[model samples]
Target: MARSINQVAVFGLGKVGELVAILLADAGFKVVGLDAVPRTMLTADGVELETRPLDVTDAAAFRDSLRGVDAVVCCLPFHLNVMIAEAAYDAGVHYFDLTEDVPTTNRVMELSAAQPAAGRTRPTFAPQCGLAPGLIGIVGASLAKQFDEIRSIELKVGALPQNPTGLLGYAVNWSAEGVVNEYLNDCEVLRSGRRQMVPAMTEKERVLIGGIELEAALTSGGLGTMCETYEGRVARLDYKTLRYPGHFRQMHFLFEEMRLRDRRDEVGRMLVDAKPPVNDDIVYLHAAVEGIKAGEPFRENFVRAYLPLEIGGRLWRAISWTTAASAVAVVELVADGRLPGAGFVKQEDIALADLLDTHAGRLFGHTTITQSERA
Candidate 1:
């Protein structure tokens, strides 16, 4: 029998976590929000989510909490994901998270391969279900399917302030730690039809979307497991983070000139301090694939800009809602028996059409496509 998910526990309860809980509840699932500190009731979009205090690090307590829930979504930091996933595994529940940490995801994949519950297949383990790795990967794969042969697949995502300031011209809208990791860590890519690791923040390129000039460069974890999945299939497959012009230069100076590469935590704090998050933010997504379709040379591009909008009676930043909704959409798919019930779930394997069919996934439906060129 396939696994059925009706109840879910969302761990973290931050800006994104609370929204995830609300979206799940709005989707007709019983939802609970867990956090390290105590939290009162949270309601949104005509749905109320039960909230509780729990230290996810407490393995016994976390495992116990997962007993009644059909699935668990971890919105905690990437470092805490493996611990939370272990508890979910022991409790025999489906697991999902928004982590871009490669090592953490590797650990989760190992857990998914372990023994299943008695008379049932193991629960699904899906990670990197955020905007870049989650929605962007789905888009890239969907475009790749239309081609008989693929030469390259390029993806770019940026969550930035609509109005920028300072030399960086960016805001700390997302996790500063994750941002630092993406900059300092080595990025995985498929070069010349072989898997290769390249330095992040290198190979800078100019990108124009809807007449907006931006810069893009290699970013770690944004590609998720696509490199491994599309290694021999595509000659060039890579994901990059887009930023306003001169943002990468400032970052290069911070990490290279100041030599803060080894001190990621401090760098995160410093960056957050310098550029706090702004309420008015926009998310830009650009996905392009080149290959042959029906024996004809072709290139397809998906480019859109997402702005903050009201959800659950409150306005949410573009970064927060997009991330939360993407993850919730995946959970909805798994619950409705559309996605696999067991083993690790790769974002590339998910269908974009199926994703947009869900309630949460509808947020991506409004696209101001600046480029849909086919040649």
Candidate 2:
């Protein structure tokens, strides 16, 4: 039987969490916004959201809050995801999050696997349902299906200010801790049909899209489970974070030379203190798949640039809208029986066409192109 999701609890009141609460409320779900600090009262399309003050670190409080809730959408930091996920599993409610941390996601997977044996009702668990690992992974899988034999699959995504005016050439559009983690961790990729790990910030390359040159480098967690999904199939598969030229060199200097990578807490604080958050930003996405179709070599590229959007009677940054919308859309799919209802779900399992048709996902617009372009 398909479980109907009505009441949803969104843990975390940050930018992305706020939007998630609003979007879900507007979609007619009873939304509860929970955070360590109380959120200012707000409404979406005349729906007043219920706000709760609770510390997610308090396992008892967190589990108690899940009572009577149909689903749990976690927008908390990556490190706190496992705790909330375990609580959600204990409460027997659907779980979703935007975490890009590999180890945290693995923990969620483990919890999802420990559900009661068959014939029992187990809630679904899906992670990394955000920009890079979420939408990009779905698009990459869509393109890969078009090829008779996949050779290489590459994904690049970035959230950058529409107008640059700084030395770093970047603004804090999302979580600074997430940015630091990606910069310092080892990235997973597939080479010659085998899975391998490579250091982040390496393999810097210049890429041109829409007549603009941007730099991309190996980044951690952006590939999500795509490397595992495409293992033993694709000859090469990897994901990189896109940034303006000279950005990688500057990051390399800070993490490698300054030794900030050794002390991530200071690095995160430094980045937050230095780079101010920007609302006028663009979310850039690009995915390319190369393979043989009918014995003829071919390649296809998917590209899009998303700017700030007006939704739920407010303006949201591109990063916030893109990330929040992807998570919400997955929830809708799961609720509507369009996706799996129990156990772990991967972003690649979501179809691009289905995602673009959702109310929240539609905010990304329909500008995606599937052309014979090589990258």
Candidate 3:
């Protein structure tokens, strides 16, 4: 049964979209999904969604697909998000996307200014609502609020296999192109009281979570709004993704020796064609903030774990659930007026504590909010 949907549209039915669409329908919201390939749009109940084979780049068809829709969810690849976001802005529907591409996100934010200046046709615009940047952004920002002068913020997040089977011990849960784009792209970081481009896969560090030791490195795009919000106020800030031991080493080999960094397309195609898929995975988050407290340095740390969940009779790996569920939960929360009414909304705009209180993200854990380390 599709439940009592008010009519929502989801673009893309890959892992994230499938999980989100089913949950939306189950919650009684009519959902229409748009994808270039018709076979990807799964359906249910008389609440059959209105899916149209759309190239998305064709603005005419894209805008037309938004007809009679109140909200739009994008599960498309990051490169494909710009067109859909433009269409959603034109259609005046609340827009949501799962993109970690900073340039793309900045473009959307620029467009957010034009919205509401015209009218409140669209109520909200959220970019980068997936796991790393989205969840970690919220967590890091929340910690920064405690300090009088925010000096430094560091956030680390990752998606990895629960059990290993290969040289990399990794499975491609989402987009291989996205993974390549991030690893090869110019990374952003705040060093020495200034933001600068840092090489990806450097500054490797080890952490213990859920009693399992893991390694973390400077992969791109997890720092959602931290740099923007902190800016000159903070001395140093950065974000990285975490993975199991030896994962970074293997990635370096592929990107360096195999020269995947130079020829991303060939490497992406190779990985897409060759990798073995796995079901079980885990999403890990670690964030810390330091600033002046009573003329002295104070710090706060937070960590959480999210595992797999079964949706639509299929097991949603932790990456799928963590990424999709964060967006789903935020959309539901924003719909209910639990968040801001209009303009660009950052992941950090919503408090971490309140988000965890919600039933959706709580599936992760109670989560330790405040931990101290001497500086």
Candidate 4:
């Protein structure tokens, strides 16, 4: 009965981009899916849409495409989000992206700060609107509000294949570079109200859920934008990625002893060579909030069971729906004035309850499960 998002533009019609377009289009929005490699994009399973060939690196061309669009949902890889986000700002379009690049997000934040606030006619900028940083930030922030005094918040998420045919039990569902880069980078963790950097694979733990044995270890970007939002409210906060058993050890060798961390170019090349890619995958999310509740310590958790599903005849992995839809929900919310509607917006700025009621975020509501079931 309510219309918030009308005109939409999705940049980069890759594996995830196609799904994003179909879902938004299904929501009764005018959607345009653009890509640099037009040859790589094909019609999604259930929807019929035209693809605009775009070279985002060309500043003028990129801005020209943004004209008259209310919000731009960036489905491009992490590297391109920076350029695309800048263009969105210059074109006076609200921005939403799936970038987990800390540096890129920081730059966007800086740009948002330096630029003049939006007038009544322009859209604001909201970057890094994916599962981990996007949904986790919103959901975790919601749980925090229920507490009298918060202690810590930990968010862990993984976009993996629902059904696997290989030993990794995984597929190239998302960005391979994003995966390898986070694995190698020094991760940030808050311990006792102080911020510290921890090695990616150093802190390992074994977790079993639904009789499915898996491993979770420290990974950058999984915490999303929670670190800045939770600042002093929480004491210890960190994020990890869930993987099948023994997967950590195998990657430890490839990234550490084998020096793939130092030679990621070679490592990324090997992944392209060895592992086959697929579009069928699952997106896993786990977030826990601990704090004092009525003079008692309590924890509130959110978890979900996501799998690839068919929408409008096209099938896409759970990650595509969860990540893209969550970002789009925020875009819609901001457009409708449910959010602040101007300047920089963070994922946590969204109210989880309101988000779950929206069309795009309702996708998360249907796929969700209890924390114990997903853990």
Candidate 5:
């Protein structure tokens, strides 16, 4: 039998964390929002959130915070997730996060695959619940299922200002650490039915959405476990980060020529300082799968441009709301027993239709363009 989830504890009260807590509370769950520093109870969009300070580094205090919680949603940095996940495992509560860090996810997988004591119900460890690794993987996998034999799966995502400025043509609407990590870490991909690790920011290619030109290149952690899941079954599978033209060239010069690769924190700070968060931002998603449908070649594309909108009487950025909504929708599914109560949950394992059906998932609507073609 599946365990019921009612009360949820959300760690990290940053931009994304606060909204996740509010959205969960709005979904009828008892929510406890925690952060390293003190936070006032939030009453927004008709939802009253209970928030408090919590130093997660303190082991006893961290465990104590989970005492009456049925589940935990971690919106903290990637490096901090393994610690929170380990604690959640010990506490026997469901765990979820929005980490795109490879090592962090591997640690979560180990915890989920561990053998629980006799009669102990293993908690669910669902990571990569945000937009790129989360929704993009879901969309790619959903499209792949329609084919008898999949030849390739291509995914690209960009969260950028609707209007561009400067050479970078970007804004720091997300975690600077995350963006830097993706740009620096090695990317896992499936090429010619074999899994391989490739350097990030390579494999540059041109991409067009709604007649707007963009460039894409391999990025770390965007594929999540899709390469492993689709290995030997699919001929090609890769994920990339979408950026405006000439963006990658500038990135190469900054990290390569300027030698800022090892100093990730400094680079992140510099990037954020230059390009802070923007209110008028757009989240572009392009997922394409090519394969045999009914013994004939076919291609399906799920492309959309997500924009900021009013939610709960306030406006939220495209990146913020999309990440928050996707994470909250997965939480809602687990709370309603729509997903497994125990064990590891991969983003690709989720059905796109079911995800869209959730209260928060409805925000992913308004597809700018969807295409089906013959290859």
Candidate 6:
């Protein structure tokens, strides 16, 4: 059995990283928050936290900080995650992150599969532990298991203002780079038992949730490893991002016609400067699976909405809370042996019920499962 994790080193002090440190500390783990820039003392729910100043890009400094730490949770930018992940592997500590970049995740998977040093235990590497790629994949995989002959699996997730007032009908509650990347990259899917890539924002469809009309379209990284996990078993599997009506058309213009997709950095800056983050945000989650169960075709829908939560006496946006909570929950599960301690761990490998039952995951509220008539 793997030794329990008692001390954690969290790299990066961004919004999600801050909350991750706080939540882990609140959960009674010894947490050390690391960042390149100096930061003021942090307190979550009135409990003070221990923070360190260190540069993750510096190999010696990064590996030194991981000394005596059981695990390292990375909240750094998707592009910069590989450095810290490499440091964690060298230090022989378990690693986790909320990255959605395909190339970054692939690199981490490679690191996870590599052989460890002499007599050292191999550590686990779990990535994309946030929102769409995190909880959505967990729920989708769980639902897919209920069927004997899987047909289609659809996933849609969004973080939007409760009362959208912008031209795009959205707010930048999360990383601007992430939004632009998902919007511009090709999405992975399984069509007719074959894995394929489709253009993002091409399959626009209107969906209604709780009486509000929303739009969903193909998006990258949201599917995590589900396409590969269910490739041959499920006939059709795809993931889409939900937005308010007309948002897709506007994005299509900026990315396709205006050629912003070619200039992602400028586009990211524009979004950060324009769509300011909102506190009163809602996270919409929807997962549906269709397959033959007990000789009858069945369809199951798992839907839930998350709002801003008051944690540790602070009001956290729905996106921040949900994303941080998912990462924290996975860390706890790893610490307790509920998950693998070595090698690459995919989001779909986690069971939905196990995730929801965790203390941190309870913020999303209970999942509602509905069954549709036979197709």
Model 4 has a clash total of 5
Per-residue CA lDDT of candidate 2, range 127-205, in tens? Answer: 9999878999999999998889999999999888878766678998788889999988899999999999999989989
Model 4 is weakest, by summed lDDT over 10 consecutive residues, at 39-48
- Name the lDDT value of residue 189 in candidate 4: 84
* Candidate 6 residue lDDT tens string, 194-296: 9999999878999888888999999899988888888888889999999999998998899888977789999988987888888888988888889888889
Task: Write candidate 4's Cα lDDT for 72-191 as tens digits.
Answer: 888887888888777776676677778878888887887676655456344577887788778887877887788898888777787766566555666666777888888888887888
C-alpha RMSD values across all candidates: 1.6, 2.1, 3.8, 2.9, 1.7, 2.1
| TM-scores of all candidate predictions against the true structure | 0.97, 0.95, 0.87, 0.90, 0.96, 0.95
Pairs in steric clash, model 6: 45-312
lDDT on C-alpha atoms for all candidate structures: 0.89, 0.87, 0.76, 0.75, 0.90, 0.86
TM-score of 1: 0.97
Residue range 47-114, candidate 1, lDDT tens digits: 45688889766767877788789899999988999988988887788999999999999999999999
**Compared to the true structure, candidate 3 yields what TM-score?**
0.87
In model 3, the Cα lDDT at residue 64 comes to: 82
Worst 10 residues of 3 by lDDT: 364-373
Q: Model 1: which ten-residue window has the lowest total lDDT? A: 40-49
Off by over 4 Å in 2: 1-3, 41-43, 117-120, 366-375
Question: Across residues 222-254, which tens digit of lDDT does each residue of candidate 3 receive?
Answer: 776667676678888888777778888988898
Ranking by lDDT: 5, 1, 2, 6, 3, 4
| CA deviation > 4 Å runs, candidate 5 | 1-3, 41-45, 117-120, 367-375
| lDDT tens readout by residue for model 5, 63-107 | 899999989999998889999998888888899999999899999
- Local lDDT at 11 for model 6: 90
Which regions of candidate 6 fall more than 4 Å away from where they truly are?
1-3, 40-45, 366-375
Inter-residue clash pairs, candidate 2: none
